[model samples]
Target: MARVIALVIVLPVRLVWDALGYCLKQLWRWVLAPIGRALGWLIHHLIVIPLRFLWEWVFVPVGRALWWVIDLLVVTPLKWLWGWVLFPVLKALWWVVDLLVVTPLGWLWRYVLAPVGRAVGAALAWAWDVAGRISRAVGRALGWVLWNLIGRPLAWTYRVILTPVGHWLRTWVWAPVASVARAVRAAAREVRVALFGGPR
Candidate 1:
């Protein structure tokens, strides 16, 4: 009786549990798993594949074509223009400047300014020579005056006054001092000879 009662109670609960499990499995298999797989496939095909194709076929080629066009149209032309037109134009402008401005300036310097400068230099040289001659003449005159007035008087005073005074000092003062020094030296030598008994 107890086993029959337990079976009656547990059988309905187990059946309900199994029915719930079955419903979960059916929902996962039919709905959720299919939706997830479909979403993955759609993302791969629509977004990833198309983006890859476009990148490989469209974008890379388009970028390369743009680079080629830029090289052909812009870069090449600019290089050519710089090499052919602009460089030649600059060279011609420089030549024109040399011909028009520099050459004329050089000619002017050579013909007009140079001759004027030479003439001015010659005049300055002549003036310098004349000034030098005048300075020499003044110097000579001053020298002549100095010789007659100052030099001659100095010479005469040296000859008459200073020479006589020097001669008197030499004769009176120097001669007596020299005689006294010789006498003292002789006395010293005689005393030394007497004391030491050596030849005088």
Candidate 2:
């Protein structure tokens, strides 16, 4: 019974809330429609119409007239004047370019190359001298070490380690292979002489 009562109360409240929402929406549209119409009228009559007129009547013809006058008065005269007055000016400019840009660049090359070449030459000479000194020192040190400390011991070590291996290979592997190769060669020569009527 309590649940049924609660449901009945909630249903009427929902109905009232929906009716209020619909009424508020209708009222808002009714109020804003006139304001929107007025704003449209204001923009069309005041802003857009004047802007269109200014663009069509003032901006286009004035810009065209200005361009025509500039072409006739300024650009055409300057073009002609360029031939008359600009020749000497261009010659002067060329001379200036030769003096300022080319000559200075030539001088810069001489100035820079001489000093830089000299410095590089000096540096290379110094480097070569230092390298020679270092090489001599290292060579002397290595020679002394080999003569005094390592040469005899290294020779003894080589003899002890390698002599037996060398002897064994010379006796076993080298001797047998050499003998077999010689025998094969002799038989090949005999067969060739028998077939080809004596050796060449």
Candidate 3:
């Protein structure tokens, strides 16, 4: 009876557990693992390997060839032309400019312009000196004429007429007026003292 009960309980439990474990194993093998492997293969072959090949062979070589062509066709020719043609032409132009323009200007400045400037400056200085002498002579003549005509007459008049008149007025008229003012002030002081009975 005990063996029959144990078999009835344990057998069903073991069977259920085994069924679940087998299902899990089958699901992993058929679904998850295959998906992971497919993804890895796709990435390696399509994206990574192709990019590596393109970089190593196609892109690098093409870039190098393009640079080589640019140097051969453009840079080398431009450098050669500049060295052979443009450099010589520019040097010749500089020589011509120095000969035609610069040398002539230097000669003109040395021979023609310098002498003319010196002559002009000397003439101006001479004229200025003559003008200054003439001006001084004129000023002296005017001063002498003014002294004789106006200043001397005014001085004579002041000495002869004004001095005596001013002295006479000061002696007669001013002295009398000052004496009368002093007398009037003395009388006012006496009247104030008698009325107010104090100095003020």
Candidate 4:
């Protein structure tokens, strides 16, 4: 009973809701969709197409003509002026400089400076060789003086005086002292053995 009552109650409401939804779908598909498409077509034809045509045909040609005029009037003349006038003037100035200044300087370098430089270099080399010889002779003389004054005398003293004194100390003083110490040690050992009654 409860199920039958619920079915009866819900059936009309469901049918009304589905009818409203179907009506809304049909309205969107027929009316709103066509209106939107018409508006899109109007915008494309009126605004977009005219702008594209103007950009392609009018504006591009005008810009290209302006650039060509600027190139012909300004840039070409400047390039010709630099190539024909300024370049030759600068080249002639360079030639004058080469004739007046560079040739004279070269002559001075070859004639005067070359011989002077060679003579100076030869003199310096000769002086350096003399200085080396003098330094070597002085070093040899110094070495000879040091050997005679200090080294030979010290060697003689070590060989003659020190060696004999060391030998005498070792033989006379060390040997006698060692002998006396041995005798005292032996006597002490004998006395200790007799007093303690131990076998030696």
Candidate 5:
């Protein structure tokens, strides 16, 4: 008797689900049928009719006429201008520029600058020889005094104090600075100097 009652309850639920599924299927078919017919009609009328008309009435004769006009007006004129006018004009200009600038520049660089450069180099060589002798004498005198008086002690002090300070200054204190910030700082300094009259 409990099995019979359970089967009765499940039968009604199954029937209700089947009815809902049928209604949804019928509604979808009804909605899509009209849209499919309309699309078929549009494909027949809009696409087929215009394509046939273009092929039969417009395309062939227009294409031939365009080809002929382009051959006459565009292609012929371009060929004539390139062959007769443009090439010769560009070549002539190139030749003129070669004569005026390039040839003279080559001669000047080769002959004129070569001799003048040799003369100036000889004078500089002589000056450097004289300066080298004088600098050697001065350096010897300074070296004698430093070795006798200040060399060892001063070197020791610098090694103790300045090496670490120089490293710290380079790595942490002084660095690559932005140009805009530098400019702003300089402007501020100038304004302060003008306002305060620069350290009395």
Candidate 6:
């Protein structure tokens, strides 16, 4: 009795629940799925494709044109300033510096300082040679005067007069002194032997 009653109660509820699940599944598969696919296709074609095309074609070309305008107006003028105006001005300044400062200094060094220095050196060398010659001549004159005046007289006195005088003194005075000394020594020996013994 209880089993029949439970079946009668649960059977309609389970059938209704199954039917609702089938309807929901079919709606999702047929209606909602196709609508979602269509929405995706429309968003891709209308919004995404148009935006990509606009970015590639319109916006990119406009940006390139703006860049070209800036390059032409601003950058080209700056290039011309450096190339045509400022570069030539700097070159002219370098030329002026070379002309006024460098050229004169080079000329002064090459012409004035070099020649003057060479002339001064030559004059000094010539003066040195003349002074050396004068000194040599004075020395020769002094040597000639000394040899004739003092050295010749001294040589003559030593050779002729002093040599004979020294020989005469040695023969006369030295011989007598040596003889007297020998005689005295012999007499003293004889007296010493007479006072002491003959041999000890």
Best by lDDT: 1
C-alpha RMSD for every candidate? 22.9, 22.6, 17.3, 11.5, 21.4, 27.1
Between candidates 3 and 5, which one is better according to lDDT?
A: 3
TM-score per prediction, in order, is 0.51, 0.44, 0.58, 0.58, 0.52, 0.41
- For model 1, residues 43-160, the per-residue Cα lDDT tens digits are 9999999999999999999999999999999999999999999999999999999999999999999999999999999999999999999999999999999999999999999999
For candidate 5, report its TM-score: 0.52
lDDT of each: 0.99, 0.93, 0.97, 0.97, 0.91, 0.96
Candidates 1 and 3 compared: the better one by TM-score is 3
Task: Look at candidate 5 and give me any clashing residue pairs.
Answer: none
Candidate numbers sorted by TM-score from highest down = 3, 4, 5, 1, 2, 6
| Count of clashes in candidate 4 | 0
* Total backbone collisions for each predicted model: 0, 0, 0, 0, 0, 0
Once superposed on the true structure, which residue ranges of model 6 sit more than 4 Å away at CA? 1-103, 178-200
Query: What TM-score should be assigned to candidate 2?
Result: 0.44
Question: How do the residues 4-41 of candidate 6 rate in per-residue lDDT, one tens digit apiece?
Answer: 99999999999999999999999999999999999999
Error of 5 at 81 (Å): 1.1
Worst 10 residues of 5 by lDDT: 171-180
**Per-residue lDDT value at 55 in model 5:** 81
Q: Could you tell me the lDDT of residue 134 within candidate 6?
A: 100
Of 4 and 5, the candidate ahead on lDDT is 4
Candidate 5 lDDT over 12-31, as tens digits, reads 99999999999888877897
